[model samples]
Target: MKTIVQTPDAPAPIGPYSQAVKSGSTLYVSGQIAIDPASGELINDSIENETRQVMKNLGAILSEAGMNFSHVVKCSIFVTDMNNFAKVNAVYGEFFTSNPPARETVEVSALPKFVNVEISCIAIS
Candidate 1:
C-alpha cells in the first residue's frame, strides 16, 4: 500500500496532488517551487534564493517521510533558463555534499508560477 505524505512546513499544493507518496521504503516527492510556506510568496528575487527555497520545500517533504538528502536516490531539477543552472546548482549542492543523489537538471520552457527553478526527488528510508 502507498501512504500520502503531508507537512505544514511545506507549501500547500496549488492543485490536487499530495506533497509526496511512499510505497514500501521508497518515497517520491513532488516537484517543489520557491513559494514560502509561511507567506505563500514566491522567492524569485534571485536564482540562489529561489533554489534554496525549493530545496527547503523538498526537505520539508523528506522530513515528513522520515528521511533527508542522504536518503535521496534521485532528483530532477527543472529550470526555465539554462543561464541560471550554475546558480541553482550552487544552492542545490549545499544540500548534498557527499554521496549525492543521482540527478538530472533540465531547461524547461516554463514552470508553475513562472518561477525559475523547480525540484523533485526520490528517496528511500
Candidate 2:
C-alpha cells in the first residue's frame, strides 16, 4: 500500500502534492525549497542559507516518515545557478556525514518563489 506523509515542520505543498509518499520500505520525498513552514517566508538571504533551509525542510518531511538522512539512498538537487553549487554542497554535506547518499545536482532556469535551491530524496525504511 502507498501512504502520504506530511508534517507541520515542513512547508505545505504549494500545489497539489503531498510532501512525500511511502510504498513498502521506500519513501519518495518531494523537492523542497526554502519556504519556512511556520512563517511561510522564503529564506533566500544567501546560497548557504537557502540550502540550509531546503535541507531543513527535507529533514522535516523525513522525520515525519520516521526516517533520517542516514536512511536516504539518493538525492536530486536543483539550482538556478551552478555558481552556488559549492556553497550548497557544503551545507548539504553537513546532514549526511558517513556514506552519504548518491546525488546529482543540476542547474535549472528557475524554481518556485525564485529560490536558488531545491532538493528531493528517496529513503528506505
Q: Pick the candidate with the highest lDDT.
A: 1
Task: Evaluate candidate 1 by giving its C-alpha RMSD to the native, one decimal.
Answer: 0.5
Give the alpha-carbon lDDT of every model: 0.95, 0.95
Per-residue C-alpha lDDT of model 2 across residues 86-111, encoded as one tens digit per residue: 99999999999899999999999999
Candidates in order, TM-scores: namely 0.98, 0.98
Residue pairs of candidate 1 with colliding backbone atoms = none
Task: Provide C-alpha RMSD values for all models, in order.
Answer: 0.5, 0.6
